[model samples]
Target chain A: MSQKEDLSLFVREALLAGRPRPEIAEVLVVAGWSQGEVDEALSAWAETPFAVPVPRPRTVVSARDFFVYALTFVALGIAAFHVVWLGFLVVEMLWPDSDGANYWQAREARNSIAAILVAAPLYAWLTVRERRRLAADPGLYRSAIRKWTTYVTLLIAALVFVIDLIVALASFLNGELTGVFVAKVVIVAVVSGVLFAFYLRDTDRG
Target chain B: MNRVLFALMGLIGVVAVGTGLFVFGGPGTARAEREDQDRLMAVNDLARAISCAYDTAVLPEAIGVTSFSDACRPTNLRVSASQLMAGGLLTYRRLSDHRFQICVIVHDLGRSLNSAPYSDMTAGPEGAACLTRDMQG
Candidate 1:
């Protein structure tokens, strides 16, 4: 059998033998399996007062869940991007530079506003619908696609957060940290930071 | 908590869009800006034709469209009816032998007047925001 299969069998047998989880984990660690591997192997079974070890519900693949989650997150991504864009544009308008490019800046603001108008509502709707579904069936949170998409979103948000700070620091070093520039930087941070924090909490909950 | 965030986002989107629309005007503002650009382009074209054919064209008398078209024929530029009707009438006047002025109607004078090329032009009443040029210069 594969090493993973062996690990699973070992964990199940140990649990059935009425060994404490920490003792089993310590034994696995002594055998050179990582703590994460041991924990995953142990967590495969639910803790219950049953005669035998009971398996937890595994992550199921659902096409409908994939579609709903994908759409919801895509809409959210678009909305977040445009919201930051619009916020930057607004800051620029309020504290215009000496070049006086208000006309073009206003035009871009309109486009960002239009994108936000479409995507934000769609995001809100899909999110509300998904929340309702999740409320009705909390087990739906265990879908593999949901976990994957959530991680992907977290990855993007984290990247944005890092990139935003990098750009702000670069601008500061260049001595271009004007009021408008700093405001734009803060806007990006707030938007991406919110997404990162929200999804980080969500993944923890699951 | 998710619902609360969603509601907050929805509210923000609506408010931002409304403020943007109020500040930048609507889709019509973009259209008007384009129309103003086309009108300015036509004015430039008309001025070039006038400068090119100044020797053969009539002096002063506010250079009528027919006369402007006929003078520009030999220079291989035709002042089309559509160009004239794009924004409003294009008017040309010979200020002196070496200088001339062209004016066209603009929908959003405040925006167009602040922009490049147009910013250099002189603001006049509704139908006649004028850009003056010297052929010799």
Candidate 2:
């Protein structure tokens, strides 16, 4: 049918016929396929001594996987953001600024706490459930959606670090070294650092 | 490790919520705050109506059941009857023909409402706060 399908078929036939992978790769490369394409075609099947070539497991595209991972990450984001917000509120309350104990600030703390109460439990439940599933079917590690979501989270965490540094340096230059400001900066750094570390390790495992 | 992290996060959430309640009080405090805000808005509306009426006529001794007067009645004023009956008597007193003061009893919910006309109001300890204004006619 398609050129790539034809290539995969040829590679499978060549492997079953006992043609070595490197020779097949070289033959395809000489026949004008890129080295990557030739390598990919060869690597699609396992290199085992058997009558027929065995196909390596490919990344699954499942709607259920997408839904679970989407909900898990959304909950994680909500919980993380509000935790940082609550930390900032706590800092502000402890170190009184000139304009102290605002009604709005108290209201905001209440709202943040409410969000954390809901989101944190949801995230924990989803993660535990997913972990159980992953244990049963370790092939779920090959989920393309899971990998993409993890990378997106890592990217956001990296951006938060860059922005935090920029703001910290800017505040230092501007002489805004108040206890509240410093504490808030530290809160952001600690939370984001934890997230980045956890997800980075998670991606490695996946 | 994952389980530990999840438990820790959940614990943090609970702790933060507890701290929030400790510092800011609970749902009752929130409800009181909302009631106080509504009281402020109602008082503010009454004041604005009095100021408007003072442009043409003398300030009314008391706000009417619905309207201050046909010309200066506040449109869509949301002051509740219970709020009005409870303490929002909005004691109106005239300093002069063009100057007046309106006082309303408000609960001091530790709200930092220090801005504009509210800033001018002299808030007493857990009682009536009054705002005196001159008509800019």
Candidate 3:
């Protein structure tokens, strides 16, 4: 067993032998384990109501779980793209060139609108269904893939936020800080910030 | 509940149908809208250039010359519609003195071109595809 596992086993045994957690932690700390390590080791058995360690059921991601997750993330991806597209639309409208509106802007707006129209309602339905499932069995939150996807989303959002800042700063330095540029920066920051907030909350809750 | 599921399915069907209709029916309107917007942009560019050339010209002989074309070409302006120039769908011509005519083949005549900036422009012939505006020297 790994050192941490060994520590956890020792802590469990000590707890079962009626040794106080604090006393066990102190002994481990004095035996050269850091206080943090000792505390971490002790925490493994903190909530156990019995002397024997309970075996946690292995989380099996069934096909239905995979389907729900796939749908949810796809919908979220569409929603993110739509929001960014809308931001571009806003920029074009606010800072049109000397000529005026163009065909590309119209086409982009139409495409994004169509995508959001289809995806948003579907996302809502899927989310509601998942929420119901989660409410029924909170253990569904422990799905490894679900947690991994959420963390990956959080990472991507962080990267986007940083890139947005760099772009804004570059625009300002280049004296290209037009209304459109400002609007785009604000849009990216807000979208990424919201996503980060959401996933961070989910991770915390989990 | 089955009722909620049925209602959601019904809503999804409605959205799908609505989106289908919009997607199928939208191309023509979208094309017209895009064309109108392009025409407006081209007109605005040409008008500004024409006004600049007219103001800078010292003689009538110089009017509607190559210098006028040069003035029409702005650094940032790009006219993609061959109709606007090069005699494709629209024709721009100098009609004696300070008068000019921008003749366009518009698919939708019902669309009012008498909006801001283009309001000074007057339509030519009831069924003919042409517009007339005079430049001040």
Q: TM-score-based ranking, best first?
A: 2, 1, 3
Docking tier of model 2: it is acceptable
Estimate how well candidate 2 is docked, as a DockQ score.
0.45
- Overall local distance difference test of candidate 1: 0.76
User: Which candidate comes out best when scored by DockQ?
Assistant: 2
Residue runs of model 3 more than 4 Å from their true location after superposition = A1-53, A96-98, B1-31, B34-102, B105-137
DockQ, each predicted model: 0.35, 0.45, 0.05
Per candidate, the number of residue pairs that clash is 0, 0, 1
Using alpha carbons, what is the TM-score of model 1? 0.75
- Residue-level lDDT of model 2, residues B17-119, one tens digit each, is 8887887677888776666556666667767877776776665555553565677666665665335645544566677777877666665523535423356
- Candidate 1 local Cα displacement, residue B100, angstroms: 1.4
Off by over 4 Å in 1: A1-43, A46-53, A96-106, B55-60, B68-89, B114-129
Query: Residue by residue across A27-73, what tens digits does model 2's lDDT show?
Result: 99999999989888888898767789999988888999899999989
What's the residue-level lDDT of B116 in candidate 3? Answer: 49
Cα lDDT listed for each candidate: 0.76, 0.75, 0.64
**In candidate 2, how many Å is residue A40 off?**
1.9
Question: DockQ score for model 1, please?
Answer: 0.35
